[model samples]
Target: MTDVTPTPTPTPLLEVAMPALLRHARHTYGAAMRAALAARGYDDIPANGLYVIGALALGEAPLGQIIRELRVSKQAAGQLVDALVLRGYLEREVDPQDRRRLTVTLTERGQAAADTQREAREGIDGALLACMGEEKVLHAREVLAALIGIGREGE
Candidate 1:
């Protein structure tokens, strides 16, 4: 019999590009949260809308803050917030401190969605902890946060 050589599987493109890998990870997390929300009769919520919802999960915040924190264009942020408002997941009110500014707050339904998203995130965190161990996962989070901080320093 002739000698045979084994071929190795190719690495995924995401693995080669750090940005792509981070994006893929975000997409995967978003998809999981969307699926959980849909199962709870929240199918109307769009994938991109979660960014705004999550930003407001802690409490109400100005539209500009959400746009900046999410790193999305003003138009895109406005569109997503408008859609969420229409879907009854969010409410926009004039800021008392700054009448010119609008604050986006979560409605009862929006709070539910945020809760579901948190649960999904916890599940993902658990999975990552299981696979990578607590130390590694925590370290990874630190590394990502540091990287993000570095990017912000440029602004």
Candidate 2:
């Protein structure tokens, strides 16, 4: 038998590039989350779809509420919801209280996807907690929350 060793992959240049570090981090996290969710049978949903499903998984909500909570434009949120509905992950229905308004809710499939995504997030959060410790994780969360609040205030 010929002796052959597997070749090692090269480290990407962007991994060490400062300006693209944040983008790399975001991509890495998204990839990890996607992989984790896929392992749990959520391969059909993209990250954006997962976010939208997550919001609706809580309970049925008006279209406007989803747009506001996600901080996305009406067109963007509608597109996302439409895609999810097409994929059979969500159902759009007329609100019982207000027939004129449309409400969106997760279907059984969407609920499963949301649960898998939530579990993946918890896994990542737990790893971050282990790496940074509870105190630092809490501090980081506070900082992020503050930043989000400030951003909304400015807008």
Top candidate by lDDT: 1
Best by TM-score: 1
- TM-score of each predicted structure versus truth: 0.81, 0.74
lDDT of 1 by residue, 89-117 (tens): 99888889999987778999999999999
- Expressed as tens digits, the lDDT of each residue in 1-155 for candidate 2 is 97699877768773576447656755766777689778877777744776677767766675566678777778877777788898889898888999998767788888888887777778878888889899998997787688679878998
The lDDT per prediction is: 0.85, 0.76
Worst 10 residues of 1 by lDDT: 7-16
Clashing pairs in 1: none
Instruction: Let me know the TM-score candidate 2 reaches against the reference structure.
Output: 0.74
Error of 1 at 65 (Å): 1.1
Those runs of model 1 whose alpha carbons end farther than 4 Å from true positions after fitting are 1-15, 96-101
